[model samples]
Target: MSTWLPASPCTPPGCATHDGPARHPLPAAALLLAGCALALTGALCTPIALLLGRDHRERLTRAWAYGVVRAFGVRVRVVGRPDAHRGGPGVLVVANHVSWLDIPLIAAVCPGRILAKSDIRHWPLLGPLAALGGTLFVERERLRALPATVYAIASALRSGARVVVFPEDSTWCGRGPGGRFRPAAFQAAIDAGAAVQPVRVRYFGAAARRRAAAGAAAFVGDDPLAASLWRVVRAAGLTAEIHVMEPIPASTVHGRRALAGLAQSTVASDRANLPAESVHH
Candidate 1:
């Protein structure tokens, strides 16, 4: 693996476990179908949605993203407002990765250009839709392509477009410290003189059980996408909380490394303050 491709120690048997009561098989199956139908509808409507005004498209995107999570039986609760950075430079929205749900959940609140792995471009229904929706694809395995990817992100930011990135480069189980934020993407924010918006995403059960709900939502290390999808649909009363912290001005930081460190610490501090759970053995 390229040094740029950081691997997470998190895996299904070691880090993931279903915590909450599960839905009946029949209900879970229905929810899964409903979620898939919503995704398909969104994909089919993308071409026509593109013709609408920017504001209209943003609203539509938000609604469609919100509907996808809801259809999967996950309630979304956003805490704190995102920095408007009104009439300012573009914003780099960074968040930790845990589950596939993180994509739609973040987009529901802050719809922007998603920085995704190139492999996602070939995904069945989502691949075409993501391409149409202006997702920036990065070839993680090709070190030679890194510079080009950075240029593309910087170009988008220079155009005053918000770009969302998962700086960790890998998904964690969301029960412990997540992978460190790679400093590479931070270079784009610096190049474009953009502000870095740090957002912390957490999953919890109906009774506020963080550990259980987080595991159910996590899609990590060799966990099949189909299995993760079914696990989420069958999970009862799972809620995804999005905490949008203050935006850090890239100019205030010395460089990309410092900016990346600052953003990572900002998120880590918040996670540390959450009610503690017994260490996973």
Candidate 2:
């Protein structure tokens, strides 16, 4: 692995422990089937979505993403206001990484070009779908390629495209400390003079009428994607909450490091404000 490549200490056995009721086998299977069908339907309609205008395409993507999450029996609750970036430059949407579900949850709210690892470009069904959706893949293993990747993102932002990135570079269990935001991606926003929209993503489950961290939704460490997917469907009352923080203008920040620090602090502070009882041990 590259020295600069982000890695997390979280492991499935140690961190991915569900604390909520599990769905019946039959229902879980049915939910999994429904989720797969919805994903296929979305893929089939991609050509048509591309033909529509930008606004129409955005609406379709958002609806499809929302449907996918719902089909998996996960409820979504979004807090805080989303910055529209009306009459301004493009906005870079940065959020904490937790689960694969984070992709759709974020898309349901803000449909944009996703910044993903280049390895995802070779994944099974998702690889093709991501290509169709105009995903921006970064070669994370090659630090020498970082400048070029940053340039590509800057170019996209300059064209007024909303780019979603997980600055953490690796997924966390969400129960413990999240990976810090790498300053590299923030440079793109600074280059394009774009606004930074920091979002905090948390998964919660029903626990005695109180919210508890939904470990089943985490895709951290070496957990198999299939196992995580199955766990998510089997989870009962799993809710993914997205907290959209105030947008920070890149031009106002002194440098990429400062901008990254501000955004990370903003997200961390919001997570800290959650009720003590809601946090899972």
Candidate 3:
């Protein structure tokens, strides 16, 4: 099949999408083969990351993920890069969650310790990888884990490391109704006087959407990592545009509820008027 190119700008149905072609499965196979080669490199580098201690290790892991994405033919275009100038002892980068791919994407943009669900800490390869990255595990029982979770986020922030959280608990397939946002992470920002930076991502191209819709996008959602990754590599390359909206100051927020409202509203607004050059804080 020939590749599809938009003579004019095309809008993504249901949600905003980028444009590319209907890639041949062979290309995806090649991408996967390249990915396997990278995985071998990871095996060699991971021990080095661990030996270097937690901080450097996670940074190396982030770089590895970004490299894998590049190998898979995923091009990430970041809009409104976060204001790193806003000197940060404690900054909370909060974003919408769509796929497990969010981790690598987030890591690429802002290398930070993630607040992953405790269950993921038990997964096969990912569980250990995440742990090696210094990810803070959060048990669903907020009461039982709230104190520790808060402490971990605080420490990471206080130590000059950013804390990335997906306010939305689960990944949305972009087909059905979306879910509500959990306020715990945002609340932590308010408590620690950290700025809540919001990032919105639009996975572009018809080929990408079909792959995502058919459960082929990279993420920890219902689709298995290996399978989803296979589909993404097989499809035409994807153009991902990320919008880093303005940061919300914790001082002005009442609590988590208010903070969440601000975040949700900001992301929704950005998506509605996407492809913007920048959004000032």
Candidate 2 lDDT by residue in tens digits, 146-238: 999999899989988899999999988785558889999899999999999999998887645223355788898889988988999988889
Q: For candidate 3, give the lDDT.
A: 0.64
Task: Show the colliding residue pairs in model 3.
Answer: 17-204, 18-204, 18-205, 28-233, 28-234, 100-219, 100-220
Q: Residues 64-180, candidate 1: write the lDDT tens digits.
A: 999999999999999987765365568899999989999899989888999999999999977988898889999999989999999999998888788999999999888777889
Query: Ten residues in a row with the worst lDDT in model 1?
Result: 272-281
| lDDT (Cα atoms) of all candidates against the true structure | 0.88, 0.86, 0.64
- Clash count per candidate: 0, 0, 7
- In candidate 3, what are the lDDT values of residues 1-281, reduced to their tens digit? 11221111111232222233546778778888887688557745654676775456656876887876678767776788776634556578887766655666777667677888788899887678768757889876446567778777877776767788877766654332234566777767766778888887556545424434323352433445676676567546565556788888877888888888888778766453323321111
Candidate 1 residue pairs that clash: none
TM-score for each predicted model, relative to the true structure: 0.94, 0.93, 0.76
Could you give the C-alpha RMSD of every candidate to the true structure, in order shown? 1.8, 2.3, 9.0
* Model 1 misplacement above 4 A: 275-281
Which candidate number has the best lDDT? Answer: 1
Q: How close is candidate 1 to the true structure, as a TM-score?
A: 0.94
Of 1 and 3, the candidate ahead on lDDT is: 1
